[model samples]
Target: LRATHPPPRPSFCWAIHRDLFHYCALNLAYMAPSAREVDMALRLGFGWSLGPFEQWQLSGWSEVAAWIEEDRRAGKTLVDLPLPDWAMDPQRQVVHTPQGSWSAARATLSPRLSPPWLKRQHFPLRLLGEGGSTAASAGRTVAESEAARLWTLDEDILILTLRTKMNILGEVALEALDQALTETEGHYRALVLWSPDPHFSAGGDLKGFIETYTRHGLTGLALAQERFQRVVQRLRCSAVPTVAALQGYALGGGCEVSLHCTRRVAYTETNLGMVEVNVGIFPGAGGLTEVARRAGLRALAAQSPLQVADYLQEDLTRILRCTVSQSAQEARSWGWLESGDVLVPHREELLHVALTQALALAESGYAPALPRLFPVGGVEGRAQMLAGLVNALQGGQISAHDFEIGRILATVACGGELPAGTLVNVDYLLGLERTHFGPLLATQKSRERIQSFLETGKAVRN
Candidate 1:
C-alpha cells in the first residue's frame, strides 16, 4: 500500500515533523506534570539548549499551532489525538508576557517557578519582563552595537553581552565594550562580562582576521590587535568593580577578558584556556601577560630561588602548550581562575553568582588592582624556557611553527632580554604582547594556521 501510493515530496517530511511536534504538545497538555519540568528535564538530560515547548515558542507558537490544527483537520496526525483548545488558540502562547509560562494541564498562565534545588538559577535578562526579549530591546540596554550590548542587571550592575557569532571578540564587540566601560564608570556600581549563549566566547574572530589580512595586510591585523588589547586593558583598569560570569568555552581573547576582571564566577563545566597558539598566534590580547604575571606572583611567594624556578617552569609550560582547562576546578588549578573566584555547579546560576560577587565588591569599597612590578627571569629565564622547546623541536613533539610561537611566548613571559629577577609593571608586559604579536601575525605559516582554523573550525599542525 505504501509503495503503491507514496507520500507527496516535501509534505511527507513536513507531516512527520508536524506529528512529532503535535505529540510533544499533547504530552505537555496531558502526560507532562509541568511544562517547565519537562523543559528542564530535556535540557539537563539531553544537553539541549532549549526544551521542546521553549523551542516551539521561539519558532512561533501560533504558527506551529495553526499547522498542527490543519494537520488534525486533514486527519494527517499519526496519533490522531485531539488538539487541545489552548494549543489551537492563536492568542495563547507557551511563554506569555506578564503572566509567565502557560500551564497546559491547568489551562492557564502562571508565574514560572523553579524547584527548591534549582532556586538560585535564573535567566538574567528575563528579570526585565517582556522587554528582556533580546539585547536590542530598549528597556534595559544602556549601550548596544551589532556585536554586543550593555544591559542593566540587578543592583545597578551592568552586563556586557557579546552578540557576535560564537561571541567572538571583534571590532564591533570591542567598541561596545569601550562604550560599556565608559557608561559603567560613574553610573553603574559594577559590570559583568557575560553572554546568554552556551559558549562564553570562542576567541578573536579568525574570519575577521583573515579578511583584514587579505584587504590591508599585516598592518590592519596589527591595528585590530591594538584595539583589542587597549579595550581589554580598559576592562582591567576600569573604575568600578568588574566580574566575568564565565561558562562553556572561554578561549583566547575570552579568557583574556575574564583574566582582566576583578573577579570571575565560572560554571563547573567552563572550559578556559589561552589557545591562540592553535591558530599560530600567541595570546596578543594580554592573555600570556596575565599568565606570566600570575606565575611571577607564585614565584614571589616561594621561599627560595629553586622553588621559584620550579614554579616558573610549571606555569610557563602552560603558555607554551596552550593548555585549556577542562573544568572550573582545572581552571582554578591552572591559575586561570584565582583563589577568590567562584565556581558554580549549575550553569543557570553563573550570572547570579557573578552579580552577587560584583555587588559584594562594590559594597566593600572595590578598587582596581594597583599596577605593580613583578620579577621575571628575563634573558636567563627566556633561555631556560626555550631549552625545553628546543628539545621538543629537535624531537618529533612540535612543529617548526609551534617552536617559533613557543619561543615568542617564552620571550614575552621572561619580559624580553632584560636581566633575570627584573621587576616589570603590567604595561611593560602588555607592550611585549603587542610588539611580538605583529611579527607572528606577519608570518606566512601563522596566516596559514589562522586560515585553516577559520575554514575548518579545527587547528592544523602546521
Candidate 2:
C-alpha cells in the first residue's frame, strides 16, 4: 500500500495483525470506510476484533519493536495506516478505530447476514479497503478511550457494562460493533451485556447533536436519528442470544439503546425510563417508534421512582418487568446474571468472566433472529387495539407503546433474516419526528429541565 500521507508508527504493526489482511479480504465489514459500522445486534453488540485475520501471518511474527529498529536501519516506510482522518475529525489524534459486522435471528430463521447484495449496495467496495492496520473512528470519543473498543461474545456467558464511566462508543462504538461481529461470525452461547460503571450510556454527545442542528436544523436531527436507528436496529437483530445487564441507570439514548437488546436484566433499584418525554422531545432515535410499540412497562415503572421499593417488597416483578437482584454480586448467583456476568462489585470475577467468555463465544454456533414487536417493536393488538406504531410510522403518525404494545411490536420486528456484517439502518422512516416532534423536544418542559441540569449541573425543581 502506498501512502498519500506520512508514514505511521511501527508500534501500530502489532495492532495490525497480518492475519487481518487475509481475513479482511473475506470479511465484508472491513470492506469500506463506512463498513466500519456494520450491524450490532446479538452477533457484535459489544465490539469486534481480528475476526478475519490470517492466523499464520500473525503467528511467530513478533515485529513492531524490531520493525522500528529495521526502519531506522533500512529507511523503509515504517509503521502502518494513518488513523486520524482530519477530514472527519477536529482533534485529529492519529489513531485507528477498527470494526466488525452485527446481526441476528431467532430459531429457524438464519442469523448470519447473507453476504452483501452488492448490486443493492449504493457504494462500490474494494476488498483492500476492508482489512488494513489503518482505520479511523470518526470522533465519538478521545483516542485513548479504552471503553470504546468493539468486543465479541461466543461463550454461553460474558459480562458487559453499558453503564460505562468512560461513556465509550460514540460514532466509533458503532464501528466497533460491526468489527466485533465480523471477527466473531455471529456465533456464541450467552452474552451478558453489562457495564462496569453505574451508567449505561449518557447517549449521543449533545455537542455533536448541536453541531448537526446548527448545520441542518430538523434535517440534522433526522440524520442523527437515522444513524442511531440503524444502530439500535442492528443491536436488536444480533444472532447470539443476548441480555443487557442493568444496575443503575440507562438513560436517554442509552435507555433507547437498551430497548434494542433482547433482554434487560436489572437490579430492583436500577432506574430505567425514557425521560425524553419529560424533556419535550419524544425519543429522537428509535425511542418514539420503540416506545409506542410496547406495553410501556419499563417507561411507566421506571418513571415512578418507586421501582426499587416495589422490587424489594416483591410486589412488581411481573408488573415492573425486571430481573431485580438484591445486590450487584447476586447478578449471577440469583439467576439474573449469566454464568460469567459481572458487576463492579464483582470486578475481579467479572474481568475473568469477560475474557473467558470472549474466547469461548469466539467459536459458538449462530442462528438468525426474530425481532420482538409491540406497541414498541412487538406491535400485537393492532388488529384490535388501534392502527399501532408500525401503522403510524409506516404512515405519518405518532404512536406510543405500553408493555402489551411493546411486546407486540417486538414480535413483529423479530422473525426475519439478518444481513450478515450489516445492520439495517432505517433512516428513511425516521424523518417524520424532526418536523413534528423535534421542535417540542427543543422547547419541552421536562426535557428543558433535564438539559439544563445536564448542561449546567443544577436542578431547579425539587
Candidate 3:
C-alpha cells in the first residue's frame, strides 16, 4: 500500500462500475431501483466507497456509455444487454445524493431503512452554521465557526457536527463542541456528536501537530493537547444527554470522545480503537483513563472484584495492540463501545438512531454521569503488568518501545504511586497520563516514530 504501487480502486469498481455498465445494463436499462438502495447495497454489501451511478458520473456517463457502445460493436460484450436509459440520456435526473452527514434531503430515506427503535416522528433536518450559503437548500444554518456546526433536527435535538477535513479534533472543532454544548443547554434537550466526513474522526489532526511540534517543539504541542483534553473532559461531564454517532474510523481521540459521550450509536461497520500507539504514543487524551475506568466499573458491577485487575490489564493490552475494530461488535469487545450502546446495521441510519437515543435520555431526564473513584490494584497491579510486558518483550511478542509504552500505560492504570486496592479519580489518572506523555514528546524515539508516521503512514518498530 505505497504511493508507488498502482492505486487501488474502490471495491467492486471494476466489476460493477465498468463491466456491469456494459454487461448488465439490460437489467437496469428499463427499470431502475431507488438510487438509495443501489447505493446502500454497494456500500453495505461490497464495502465500495461509491456506488455505480456516482462512479459513472465521475467518469462522465455520456463518455463511458459511448465507450461501452463502441466496445459492444467490437463484439466485446459480456452479455447482449441493452444500454441503460440514463446512460443514453445523460441529462436525466436520478434520485441520488452524496452519502454525507449534511445531505438531509436524502436523509428522509433513512427512516424507512432504519430500525424500529429509531422513532422518526418529525425530525426536520436543519443545518446549523456559517455554511448557510451552500446548505440553505437543505436546512437552516446557525452561525458557528467554519470547522464545526450545530445542526437542529427537531426542537429538542441538537447535532454538533465536525466539518473539518476528516473531522479531525482540532482546536476549532473542540472549541465549537464546547460552545455547542454550552449554548444548547435549556434550549436543545439533547446533543448528537456527528460528522459529514466518511470517518467520524481520524483522531487529532496529526498534520496540525506535526506543524506545531516542528515549529515550537513539545511546549506548543503540550498546550494544544491540553486544550483538547479539557473539551473531552467537559463532554464526559456535560449535563445534557449526549450521543456519539460513529461510523468508519474513530481512532485515538475520536474513540476517546465517543467513550466520554453519554451513549454511542455506532454503525456495525465502525473501525474503532485507541490507536495512538501506532505513532509511539499511548491514548493520552482520556482514552487510557476511560478504558481502564469503564472496564473496572463493568467488573465491579459483575460482583467480581478480583477480576478488576484482569479487566484493566486486558484493556491496557488492547491499547498496546492498537487493534482497530473490524466492526462495532468487535469494538464493544475491545471496550471502546459499552454494552448498553446501540449498534446500527446501516450507516445511513446511524445519526437517526443516535439522535433517538439522545432524545430518549433527555425525555427520561438526562443527568451527567457521577464521577467515579475507579478501584485500581495500584503498585501490586503495576508490578504484575510490568512483569507480563517484560516477558512479552523478552519473548519477542512486542518491541522495546512497545514495552516502554506499556510500562507507562500500566503506571497510569495503577494510579501512579497509590497502594494496592486504592481508588483513584479521573484527575489523578489524567495527571499521570500528562506527566508520562510529556517526556515522550521530546524523546528521540518518539520524534522518529511521529515523523515516520507523518511521512510513511506506518510506525517505526524501533
Best by TM-score: 3
List the candidate numbers ranked by lDDT, top first. 1, 3, 2
In candidate 3, list every pair of residues with a backbone clash: 128-142, 129-142
Candidate 3 per-residue lDDT over residues 213-295, each given as its tens digit: 78877778778778877889888788888889998899888989988988999888899988887788888888888876876
The per-residue C-alpha lDDT of model 1 at residue 128 equals 16
Overall lDDT per candidate, in order of appearance: 0.78, 0.39, 0.73
Tell me the lDDT of model 1 at 103.
Answer: 72
lDDT of 2: 0.39
TM-score against truth, every candidate: 0.80, 0.41, 0.81
Give the top-scoring candidate (lDDT): 1
Task: Show how many residue pairs clash in every candidate, following the order shown.
Answer: 0, 114, 2
Q: After superposition, how far is residue 41 of candidate 3 from its true place, in Å?
A: 4.7
Kindly report which residue stretches of model 1 are placed more than 4 angstroms away from their true locations once superposed: 1-32, 49-111, 114-139, 210-223, 305-309
* Deviating ranges (above 4 Å) for candidate 2: 1-147, 151-169, 181-183, 186-192, 265-269, 296-368, 371-437, 444-451, 459-462
